[model samples]
Each structure stands twice: as C-alpha cells, then as structure tokens.
Target: MNYTPWDLVLDAGFLSALLIVGILLRARFKMVQAMMLPASIIAGGLGLALGPHALNVIPFSDQFGSYAGIINGVVFASLPFAGSFSFRGKLHGARKMWAYSVSTYVLQWGLGLLFAIIILGQFFDLPDGFGLLLAAGFVGGFGTAAAVGSSMEAAGWADASTLGFTSATIGVLVGVVGGLALARWGVKKGHAKLATSLAEIPQDMRTGLVPVVSKREPIGHGTTSEGTVDPLTLHIGIVAVVTAAGYGVGLGIEALWGVKVPLFATAFLTGMAMRLLLDLTPARKYVDGTTVKSISGTATDLLVAVGIASIVPSIVMSYALPLALLLAFGVVYCVLIFRFLTPRIFKDGWLERGLFTWGWATGAVATGLALLKVVDPKSKSGTIEEFGIAYVGFSPVEILMAIVAPFAIIAGLSGQFIVATIVLGIGLIFVALMGGGRADAGNRANSFSNVAP
Candidate 1:
C-alpha cells in the first residue's frame, strides 16, 4: 500500500487525537496517578495496542516518519535558556550555591550513566556489545536512546533502539518524580515553608504583568493607560524578533565552534539576553507588565501542547519499555535529590524551594512561578523576581550541562564506564568546592544503596 503524504498527515492527526483523549481521561477520570507516567505516554500505549504491534490499525513507521521533524523541533523549543536569574544577593551567593547545584546535577548524570552500563551488560542481549546503548542513555534520554538504537538496528544490532529509549525514558521519569516528590517532601518538612511565607506579600506588590520595567515616560509612539505600549504588539514583536535572531546566532555559533547547537536553543538564549538587556535599559519602564505575562504563557503553552502532539505515535511504541523506564527512574531521582539533598544544601527561603521546584518541573523559571503560585497564587512580585533571576542564572548552567552531557555520551559509547564514573566524580568535586562553604550542601551523597522499590 502506497502511503501518501495525506496518509502521513492523517497519522499525525490520529496520534494528536490520542494524546488529547489521554489528557481528557486524566483530567476527567483521574486515570493514572501523577508523578507516575505522563499522560502522553499513556495515550501512546493505547495507540500501540491498537496499532500493528497488536491490531495493525496504525503502522508505526509511517506515523513516526510523518512527524519526526516537528516533534524534534518541539523538544528543542521547550528547552530553557538563561533560566538562572537572581537578585543581587542571590548572585553574590551563587558562588557558594554552585557547589550544591553542580553536585546535584552531576549526581543525576552519574546515576544515569551507571544505570545504563549495568543494564546493558546484565540485561539486553546485544551482539556488538553495549557501548552505544550506554551512550544513548547518557546523551538525550529515551528519545535519543531510541534514535541511537534505531540506527544500530539498521546496522544489525537487535533491540538497540528499544534499550536506548527505555533508558532515556527512565531518566525523564526519574527526574520528574524525584523533583515533585521533593517538592511535596519539602513542604511536609518545612523546607518549603517559604511558600507559606510568601503568602504574606500583597498581590499588587508581586511581579506585574509587564515584561520589562523602564524608567522612561510613555512619550513613545504608542502608550496605554497601564503606562506602556500596546501589550499585543509588543509581545508579537518580541517573539518574532527573538526567534529570528536566535536562529541566526545559532547558525553562526555552530559555524564558529563546530558544535551543533540547535536553532531553538539559540533563540531561547537570544530571547533571554534580549529580555535582560531590555530590562536593564531606561526604556524598560514603558513596557506593560501584563504583556510580558501573556506572551510568555502563550509561547510556553503552544510549545508544550503542539510539541507533545506532533511526536508521531510509532516512535513511542518502538521504544516504549526503555522510555517508560527512563521516565520512571527520573521521577524517583527527582524526589530523592530534593527531599534528601536540596534542604541540606540551600538555606531556607523562596530561593531554596524555587530551586527544587524548577529543577524538576521543566528546569525553567516557570517552576519559580508555580512554586510561588503554590504559596500565593495571586501574588506576582516575589514570583517574578524569582523567575527573572532563575531565567538568567539557569542559562549558563544549562549550557554547561549540555556541553558536559555529550562527553558523558562519548564515554558511554566507548565502554569506559569507569572513566565515565571518574569524569562525573571530578565534576561533582568541582561543584562541591564551589558550593562547599554552604552549610546545607548534602555530604550524604546518594549511594547505589537503594534502587526505587
């Protein structure tokens, strides 16, 4: 049967519909537990059952092929750039904070590496050894794992893609669950008391809806009663300009450094830098606060919904087990680090809770807002400040992590698990040294002592 282009589009539509159904089921029926599997995955599972693997309604390859590019684009689009913004005091403390933050990051990375090596050797029945499979685990999570596995499958490796996807999925799951569990635990244990404390702040004092605050009067071309430019126009202009500039810069950087940083990343950084630059300028005063909030929310929501929907169902099924496991592991890890590590490392404040919240919930400043909302949904000041600082501060950290992650993949691919462990160990040491003076940094590092029961 000839798979027409229309057929491809139709398949994408079907997958999208499935995702929507899953979301509705979760909301309407409270289907599966939260901090468990994502709604998207559950939907994918349903699709798989109905597809050729079980019933042959939807062929996996055709569905996947139709939306690969779009799904990949969505992934990069959702990544946070310049997420680490802080007030002057936070910046001063950052030198100390780095110790814990870096350690936490490395701990996660190290666990992922070790998990891959152990699983590949002991479990998967591979023919060309387990180097690449391990690499897949370290680099991009389950999706990347699956991608690598698929490549290997073409080259005569059995279940390579499946194993890779499994590992990556495990990582994502662990990250989410671990992160949220920590959030809940922190509140239960007073680590999240900052949330309660933030309630004291009045609503008007919070971060206003404006994207930037400028000192200049509304003497420019367009002005509003809210004391700034038209919110809609400004937002559209910002998104358009930032997106274009980012792509341009990403291409330039790729050419100069011989490293392939995606355009979306470039755009994200560019957008962040632009934001900071605008904020620091005297012109910031003329921008309406409301516009900023609306723009940011729209961008994020669009990216999340469309991106998740476009990732054709076939890929999900092909790498189901590995992806599922990776996600599970990620959830577990997020909980562990936050509950056991964050409080010990950071002094109690909005900053502390904010860090824990953001680390797991998309690793972005949006998490700051969410944490703030949990504390006082109506207030914006403290939340905005936290979000701003986080957005700026996180950029460098993310870049650094992204750069280091590839190396971890390389080590995994080479089958030098010991070397991988050593490299990760050294990285953590640096983080500890940087954040070591802080009284809260956890000295009781995670031992392979217990796996999630």
Candidate 2:
C-alpha cells in the first residue's frame, strides 16, 4: 500500500498509545519494575500482540517492516550531534575500551559463524547469513539488526529482516532479566558496594513518573542571539538536514558503485562532520546537547516499538530451534564475559564495569547505565566516566562492525569467518595480557591505571 502523510500520523499515534500503556503497566507492576525494563520494550510487546501479525486490533500499514531501518537512520544521524568528543588525556582509556569492545564483537561474530557453519547450515536448510543474526541482534540491538537486515534483504537474503528483529527482541529481553540476575549475584558476592532494596529506589524510577524536583530542573537554555527560527527548532532543523544529507550520501555511493551499504554509517559520519563544523564555528553556542539527546532518544523509542511489532511470526516459528540455541549460547557467552573477562580488563570496579558491559552488549547503552545504577548508585566506581572516555574510540568500531561485517559475510562467508577468527585470536591475546596477572591482585593499585596500552 502507498503510505500517505496521514498514514504516518496514524502509525505514530498508535505507537504513542502503546508506549503510554507500557509506561502504565511498568509503573503499576512490581515485577516489571524489578526487571527495569524500558517502556519502549513493553510497548513493543503490546504492539506485536495487537498488530496485524497477531490479534489484528491495530490497522498497521503493509510497509510497516521498513519503518525500523528508516527511523534507525534518523537515530544514528543524530548521535554525534548529541554528545561532544575529545581525545585530550584520554588516549589510553580510549585504546583499552576499543580493544575490549572490538574483541567482544569479533568473539561474538566468530562464535555465530562457527555455529552456523558447523551445525545450523549442516543440519538445517538455512543460509550462511543466518549466522550473522546473532551478533546483529545481540550486540547491535534493533537498529543495527534492522539496518543490516534491510541491506541483506536487498542482497537476496529472504526473511533476514524477520530473523534480525526476532533476534533483537530476544536479546533485549535476555539483557534486562539476565543483567538483573547478574547484578543481584554481584551484590550477594560483595562485588557491589552499594546494594539497595526495591523500596530504596526512587519512586520516580520505580514508577515511570518524573518527580517534581526532576521536572523543575532546567535541561537546556535558549541561545543568546535568537534568529528568525527558535533555538530548539534550529537544533531539530539541523538534525533533519544532516539526516537527509546522510541518506543522500548513501544513495550517491550506491548509485556510483552499485554496492549495498548501510545508510546509518554514512549518517553517523555526516553527523560527526556536522558536529565538527559546529564546534569550529560560533554556531555551537546555539546547539544544546540535551536537546539533541532528546531527539535521538525519541527516535530510538519509536524505532524499537516499530521494529518489534514488525516481526513475522511464521518466520520466527520456522527457525525456532536455531533461535533457541543461538539465544542460549548468547547467554552463556555473556555470562562468561562478565565472570571471566571483566575482572581481567579493569583493575578496579570490575563487577560494575562487567555488569554495564553485559547490559550494553545484550541490549543498549541505556540498559548498561541502569545496571550500573543498581550496583553503584553514587557512581563511585567511575565506570560511567571511564566508559564515556572509551566510547570516543569504541563508537567507530561499533559502526564498522555493524555496517561492514554483514556485507563481508555476504561477499564471502568463509573469508569473513577466517578474518573474524583471526581478529578474535588477537582480541583473546589482548584479554589475556590485560587480565592474567591482575586476577590475583586485590588492590586498586594494580588496576588499568597502572597498565600501559
């Protein structure tokens, strides 16, 4: 069906209603509050149940599956504008973070491919690309999965989108529930310094309602010299402009080279360039970081709901066995990473860092922050600060892994596996070098601060 502007409005309205319902459910239910599940995930589940594939209560458009990728482009394009990046005095932390993150990516990809080649492909009638759904879902979350799946679909991978969405949905559920379990375990083991009961958590957090004090705090301000357009309007206007430019850039590359590329990569690069330009000029004063984050957050919530709602039940059922196995393996791998790998990488605050990494690896960064709050409510571990520094280097690796890795698999699955295995080997070496001797060191003196890159 040809979607008109009104169709877009209807789709937005339906999604908004589901989100509200999800917030209400989460606020009213103690179990959901304990899980710390995002309102978006809950909303997505409701949408899936009531959507065309299920009860058919909502009149969703036939082209609904495509919305995830399109909205993902918007989210990515707005990211670089939402935060500032600097390398001054953070080079060491950035390198360590990049190594750790890239290693995880390589490990996840290698495991997925090995399993696919050895078992799934051998036993089932699934294609080689089936292996990639694991990392695409678990590491990259819904946005990366949708973007990569759409690209793969253009390259003749049937049902890739459905598989990707299904993987993402499962990853998110596991991330929330499993991460909570891990945090609780850490508290019991004396790894978490500050463990509080559910009653200790702020009422606003337990329920999705903002406290009066939080509402009163000012997040952003108007520019000193306002032009014809409003300051907030200008910020959003810049995001729209860059988003379109990024899409155009992706199209230009495809038209010129005839290669299918993920639009989010170019969008990200575009946003970075725009950020750099704004920083270099006086225009940076008018652009508020908080407003940019709000825009990105809004796009992400809608994308998650639409992505989950678009899952094809028949496709999920057909691959049920493989899906279950993949998810199970993912849980084990994450646990091992938290239990074994985390202590080795960071000298101090290993539990806090591990919990946060597990949360992000499985779901998204916000999930990691939520897990971190559970362990160290006061942020005494400095996990958040160090992670922010490390992300400057880590984000690019994420984009490359998400955008290029799948295409590499498509080009030559064997070649991709070989390269991934080699990368994984190198990553393991780094992990061993970073974690081995420090395992016995109980003092923070032997931490990453003392280690050389």
On lDDT, the leading prediction is 2
Each model's lDDT: 0.45, 0.77
* Cα-based lDDT at residue 221, candidate 2: 66
| RMSD of model 1 against the true structure | 10.1
- lDDT of candidate 2 over 206-279, digit per residue (tens): 67778587565554666645657677787778888888898899889889998766667778889888888888
Tens digit per residue, CA lDDT, model 1, 76-127: 3323321234445454334334434444444555555455456643665334
Give stretches of model 2 more than 4 Å off: 94-98, 196-200, 214-219, 224-227, 421-425, 428-432, 435-453
**What TM-score do all the candidates reach, one by one?**
0.53, 0.89
Residue-level error in angstroms, candidate 1, position 312: 12
